[model samples]
Target: MKTRKIRILIHVAVLGLLIASCSAEDGATGPIGPAGPQGEQGTAGADGADGADGADGADGEQGDQGDTGTANVIYSDWIDSEFDANITDPAAGIDLDAPGLTQEIIDQGTVLVYGRNIVLPSNEIFPLPQIISNDNHGFRVNSPENIRLTISSLNGAAVGSRVIEDYRYILIPGGQPAGGTTIVIGSKASKQEIPDYSKMSYQEIMEFFGIEE
Candidate 1:
């Protein structure tokens, strides 16, 4: 009987152990542990690269120059023929009735060159002799002495067609004025003396004409 009791006690102990183990396995799992603490923030990243520049627009084309301006006196084939009188012959007095001797006509194809001024009456039409050859003649500006005006003929042509066969030259003479500032006047054959501008410098003439320094 004592041996039987001992066996029963051992079985009871083993049963208790098994029950404890089973209880532990059956219990519900605890809530998941809280998430780990957040890590420290990293340093800020570098800025992004800049975008490429836009292409430039095409350049505009240049504009053309304006037309040439018109002048008061323009010489061309359309105008009347030009002719001047030749009264240089002291033998014959001033003759105004000479044929084809007009008061004034802008003679073309002729160039009247002075100190720095090229008085090419681009409007005058040339006759047979477009120029006159006059030497020892004097000129004045505003009737002033010491002032000079020079002239030169471009082509050779007779002053008149009939008896008065004087070849009128287009060459105007040069001279200097003594006082006032102005261009000379009167004909080459005029008995009046012309101003002698030969003594004056080019700058003086330009100044007289009110030209820039």
Candidate 2:
């Protein structure tokens, strides 16, 4: 038969080229990879926002002045005394009619006026004894009814029953005698503020203060 059918087709074409050269080639090269364990830190990247404000400065200057002070005073020396002339008020007389009095509190001392032919108000307060004798050296006028004496004896003259020509006096102001010898007032206080014996004539009031004889 034609050469045994061409030797069985060349033994089935060399067994199909040995099953296509034993299933062909793609697959070889893998040994370099051992450096990788530090990769779990990839989750930290989120924060940044805020900034704006600045401008203002100017004004300063003024200071100076201080100096001036001094004070000193002196008057040291003067004194002498004698007492017993603070008598008034055998009854309520003298009243200045609402004027408490102020010569800086009547010059703080001595104010003796007894009303006789009046004339004192400027040295407004000091030696004011127009007259009030009994020679106890008399001095009375402080805190009475302040002017309201409905005459007791203008024509007959009296001390105890108000009206020696409408009364007047003064002894207050620590009541006399802090020191003496200043008793010589205005022309002996206008010739002894009346009392040549109420303007004399009882024989010139027994010859002016010589009392009797």
Candidate 3:
């Protein structure tokens, strides 16, 4: 009986050890523990490369050529009249040679004559057919074949022949019609009117034709 009681006591000790090793019915979870401190930040990465440039654009088309301009206009420098003779005869007039006056100019083109008087104050320039000191100061195309221009003074008060020092002439290529006219000198769409030079002053005429003094 002493042996059996010892064996029973050994069995009870083994069962208690097994029960402690096996997990008991899970109990209610305990409160969560406090969080740990954060770790130090890592070093920053390098920046990316820049983008490439774009391709160039195509070229545009060229424009058309323009029309020719007024290069045909002609002019003469001031020519001395050399008229020192006293005019006792009203019909007789002084003649001056104008070699630049071509047949085409007299027929299809226009001729303008300007004269400066020696006796006049400030050496005033006057257009032909101007009246001075009660005298009819005028000119006439004597001979188109010879290109001669005649200057005459008529109906004067016997105040010694109105002194004429020099003369000038502008030869416009295109004929000026009876009435004012317009022509296209540039591109087909543009039209410019021809000014009446006879009515224009000497300075105005010079400026219009781009002539130098």
Candidate 4:
């Protein structure tokens, strides 16, 4: 009975050991596994917030200035052809008021001093006369169409009417030949009676031509 009991105990212990060994061998290693299933994609993050604005910049320096402008000439030239030319107006290029007007007269041309012995302001304009007459102390026939009279006072160099001591006139001989002729009139003021003609201004010249200055 004792031996049978011992054999039964040994057999049970051996069977327990064999079962533990078989369990260890089965858990030790395994064959390579098949590819795993694909994982799900992660969610995207939110965008970052905007930054603050920067400070204002300083002003730039000024640039250099431009150069000065020049003058624009309007009317310059006078009459077209000077010699042997008939002039109807001063704007035609003949400066009638210029000295030696007889020479300026074109060949057989007419010189019309429209207003003769006419009084006007120094700033007023008179028309071109068929015959222009200058009045000094008295009317002396200076040319065929010119007379010289005198003014007691120039009225401070003003162009206007003036009282004189004596006044006289002489008619120009009709049909005077044209090429070049000069008419000159004189006055005998005795240096105490009336003013002289030497003192004249540009305004006076403009007035003689009936121009507004």
Candidate 5:
């Protein structure tokens, strides 16, 4: 009876040992599982503030002044003339009133006289000291009072009254400056090279002085 009881106890102890050994040994790993669904995207951040504006650039330089113009010139309208038969000695002379022709002007300024004959079809303009046919036409300055116009015969012929019909004069404020000096008259400056007014034609003189015809 004692041996049978001991055998039963030994069999029970061996079964318990086998069950513990089986639990201690690990089994082979299984295949990986399928991935889960992706999460929702986060909301975007607010926009940043705008940057400041740039400064303006610097200003440009100024330009130079222009040259002066001829504004000190004085002129006169056409004056009528008729030769007197009574004054007929050396030449036929006529005196015209010229109150503005001062002696200072005759010395330091310029005075130009021109003659025109209306009888001719072309109304020819002639600078004083001009000769027509056998007649010599000229002018002499009788300063501070009058200017004298004379007609002399070259061939000893009688001086006629039909020579000159009208006369005009231009008074420029400045004359030929001495020693290439600049002449300034009442805010007006004269050119260094004064023009030879006698050499210039009537039309050229009018255009140069900006005189209206």
Candidate 6:
């Protein structure tokens, strides 16, 4: 036989090399081999804790009382009191009628003034009287007689000099028409009208009202 046909062609070439190595993974999958280079980005997550405070809006409607700017005059909020005497013949005023002051409101022609100061605990610093309308007569806005401050004259004051005169005021109602004003004096002047208390000499009118013995 030729050696039995060379062992049947060497067993058919070893069974065709074991059927091409037993492959069933088709050849079309070879094109997907180029996609290998995308894996490096994972670190950004930390900011979530701030949201709880929103509910407060509803209360606005109470307006309707305008046009009294300076309201004719009345800004007395520093009515300090204390006068150990020395302000001759009239020592009982500083009572702006409980702040609503009325002598029919200074005879209805209003124009009061007093930012006085005569301190002396040995600190000695007198000369702060400002009772308008006249000086020497000291003070006078005593309408209808009810202690409406008729301080007549502190220009002769001297009850021994343990001195301690403190006062405050600013009332100017009575038609205001003297030009330019902003109404100030509790804060000490800016709103004009109420300047005329001159006339010195009772020791310069008691050092001009701040008095001293």
Q: Which candidate number would show the highest lDDT if scored against the true structure? A: 5
Candidate 4 on 14-91: residue-level lDDT in tens? 999988888855786778999999999899999999875556674455545422111210111122222222222222
Q: What is candidate 1's lDDT per residue for 1-213, written digit by digit as tens?
A: 999999999999999998888785788898899899999999999999988655677445555543322222221112111223442232222211222222232121111112111134432222321223432222222221112232232233322311222222222222322334443355443334433333345344334334332
Which stretches in model 5 have alpha-carbon errors above 4 Å?
1-70, 85-90, 177-192
Deviating ranges (above 4 Å) for candidate 2: 1-94, 98-100, 103-107, 117-163, 167-213
Provide the lDDT at 142 for model 3. 56
The lowest-lDDT stretch of 10 consecutive residues in candidate 2 is: 72-81
Task: Report the number of backbone clashes for model 2.
Answer: 11
By TM-score: ranked, best first: 5, 3, 4, 6, 2, 1
Candidate 1: RMSD to truth: 19.9
- For candidate 3, the C-alpha RMSD (Å) to the true structure equals 11.4
Candidate 1, 145: how far from true, in Å?
34
Q: TM-scores, in order shown?
A: 0.19, 0.20, 0.58, 0.24, 0.58, 0.24
What lDDT does model 6 reach? 0.45
Q: If both were scored by lDDT, which would come out higher, candidate 3 or candidate 4? A: 3
lDDT of each: 0.33, 0.34, 0.67, 0.32, 0.73, 0.45
Over 1-213, each residue of candidate 6 has an lDDT whose tens digit, in order, gives: 999999999999999998887777643454556778999999999999988555666445555533324534453544555443554433444444435655655554344344444443454322234343333313455543222333444454432332334444445455333333323333222334432323222244333333323
Question: On residues 85-202, what C-alpha lDDT tens digit does candidate 5 reach at each position?
Answer: 3335447778878756777767777778899888899999889888887788888887665788888888776765556789988776655432354444432232244466667789
RMSD of each: 19.9, 27.6, 11.4, 24.7, 13.8, 15.8
Task: Return the TM-score for candidate 5, rounded to 2 decimals.
Answer: 0.58
Stretches of candidate 1 exceeding 4 Å from the true structure: 1-25, 31-36, 53-213
- Report backbone clashes per prediction: 45, 11, 0, 22, 0, 8
C-alpha positional error of residue 51 in candidate 2 after TM-score superposition, expressed in Å: 73
